[model samples]
Target: MEPRQLRAIMLYEHNLGTSARQTAEKINTAFGQCTIAHSTVSYWFKSFDKGDTSCEDKPRSGRPVVFDEDLLRSHLERHPDATTRDLEKELGYDHSTIIRHLHAMGYHKIMSRWTPHALTDSERAARVTICESLLLQPHRQDFLRSIVTVDESWVHYNNKTRQAYWVLRGERAPTEPKGYWELLDEKQTINATICGEQLEKLAPEIATKRPKRLSVSLLQDNARPHTAKSVRHILEKLNWTVVPHPPYSPDIAPSDYLQIIRTHLGKELVIYDDHTYYCNVTSANGWKKYWRCTRGGGTRCCAARLHLSPDYKVMKIINEHRHPPPRFIVRNGVYTKIG
Candidate 1:
C-alpha cells in the first residue's frame, strides 16, 4: 500500500482507538470492498501517533536569505550597472552570496562569441550579388563544377559531461561529464575544408586523375582572408569561380553536406568502414558496394547497375556494419591482451 493510504489508516486508528489491522481492513473494505490486514494497519497507527502529524508529506526548508526584504528590494531597483563585487560591497555580502541573490532574483549569464558571416547589411548584399552574378553568367557551370566546399570544426576526443540533470530543492548540481577535451595535444579545433589540396587528399582517385579543366566553384563566407584581394586573384588564376555566400546561409551551402558527413564520421565506426565512405557521402557522389554471399548463400551482389532510388534498408545494414563490435571484442581481448 502507498504511504499516504497507510497514513490515512493510521489517522483513523489513532482517532478511533482500533487495532491497526482492523482499521486498515475497515478503511479498505469501506468503499472498495477490499480489506487490508489488521496487524499491518496497526503499525501505521503507531508510526503516525508517535509523530507530531500523521500526514505522509514532509515540509520543505527554503534557501536562507543573505539580505532582508528592504535591502533586496533596494538592490533590485539599483542593480542595473552593479557588478557582483559591487553588489557584495553595497549589501555587505560576499560575491557568492550576491550571485545567489541575483540567481534568486532571476538573473542569468550570457555567452557572447563570434564566427564567420558576422557582417553588416551592405557587406552581406555585396556577397550575395557576387554569387548571383556568377550564377547568372553562362560560364557558371564551368566554375560550379570545379567548386569544392571547405570548413573546419571541433570534435570531442572524450565524451564531455552532460549539462542537465535532476536535483532536489537546495541541492547542488553535479558537474558535467569529462571527455576528449583533456586527451590529445594536437589541437581541440581541427581546421578542415574541402578546398583544393584537402579535396585532392580526400578523393585521390578523382583529384590525381582529373585535369585543371575541372574548374570548381568555391563557396565561402566573408571571413577576412576569404574577402582579401589575394584570395580572389588566386581563384581567378586557377580558373576557379569564387562564390561568396550571404551571411548566415550555411543551411543551403555544400559545406552543410560536409557537416552531416563529419557528424556521421565522428560516429563512423557505428555507420561506415573507412574514410572513403565518409568522403563519398559528402562529395555528393554515389556509392560502390562490394558484397559477397557466404555459406548462407544469397543472390550475388549487383556490380554495375543503375537505379533511380536507393534502398534505405541496405543503407541501414551498412550503418550497422560500421560500428566496431562491442562486448564480444572486449571479452576476446581481455584474456590475450591484458597481463
Candidate 2:
C-alpha cells in the first residue's frame, strides 16, 4: 500500500486513542513485519496534535521565494549559536521558511560538543596567536620524537584488573551519569603536589628513551600545578625546554596580527610605529594620520606622522624616540615589533 494510505490509517488509529507502537504493530501485521515503524506513527500523531491532518506535502507558492543566502551565511558566520527564531528576528524572515532554506543549503543545527574547558575570550585569543619564531630554529623536523609526552590515568588502590569503576556509596555529582562508568572509589584530584611526582618517570623516561638527544621540548597547560616553580626547576635541570607559550598567554607580538591584518579582512586599519591610528581622509594619495601619544587626547608626536608618496625617492627620519627602541624585525621595508 502507498505510505500515505498507511499514514491515514495511523492518523485514524491515533484519533481512536491507539498507542503509536500498538497501531504500528496492527498495520505491520496486516501488511508485513516492518511495513510501518512506531516512530512514523508517533510523527503523524504529533502532526495531529498540531492540527495538521493532511497526509500530503504542503504546496509551494506560485513562485518560490529566494532567501538572501549570503546574508544568512554572513549572520551564521558571526553568530553560529543563533537559532531559527534569532535569525527570523534579525533578518525579518519567517522562521519556518528560513529553516527550510537552511536545510536546502545543507545547514543544520547541532548540539554543542563537550570540551575539557569552556575557555574565556582572552584564553581563546591567547590560543589564537601566530609567530614564525619556531621556523628560525634548526632541524626542527628531526626533533618530533624529542618532545616530552606522557599520559594520565587513574591508578586503583589494589593492583587488580579494574573491570569497571564502581562508586562506593558517595553523593554523586549533579551532572554525573547514572551508569556503570561512575567511579567506585573516591576519585583523587591531581594537585600540584601529585603532578610533579613519579608519573611514568616523565623526565627520566624521556632521557632513557632518547639517550642521544637529552634536550626535549615539553608542551604543557599554563596551570599553576603544571608550571609550579619546583616542577620547572627539576625539568630545566634535565635540559627539558618547556614550550613557553603563545598557547599559554594572551600577549601578542608581531603586534596583534589580527588587528594588523584588519585591512586584509576588509577593515580600514591605519597602523605604523607600533601604534594604531585613524586616517585624515582629506589628505592626498599619501594618508595624513594622527599620532596618539601617552598623554590623553589632542596631543600629537613632536614630529607629525606622514604617509609619503611612492614618487618621493629619498626620505630621512631625524627624530629620536623618548625611550629605548623596541625589538623589531624589518619585513620588506616595514618594521614589525617582536613579542
**Candidate 1 lDDT by residue in tens digits, 1-339:** 676765765786678777665666667777454545666566666666677554656554554444664575576455443556666666666677767766776554321111223557886686679667766878655665666665533233332222222222333333222212222124532222223344345444445666554556666654454555655555666665566576655534654322222221243211111111222132235433332111122352211111112321123222112111111111111211111
Indicate which candidate wins on TM-score: 2
Q: TM-scores of the models, in the given order?
A: 0.31, 0.35
**Segments of candidate 2 deviating more than 4 angstroms:** 1-82, 85-96, 104-131, 151-187, 247-339
Task: Give per-residue lDDT, candidate 2, residue 21.
Answer: 89
Segments of candidate 1 deviating more than 4 angstroms:
1-9, 21-34, 52-127, 138-339
The residue-by-residue lDDT of candidate 2 on 45-130, one tens digit each, is: 89998999999856764433667878888887777667777888888778788887777776644322112244578766656543
Which 10 consecutive positions of candidate 2 have the poorest summed lDDT?
173-182
Number of clashing residue pairs, candidate 1? 21
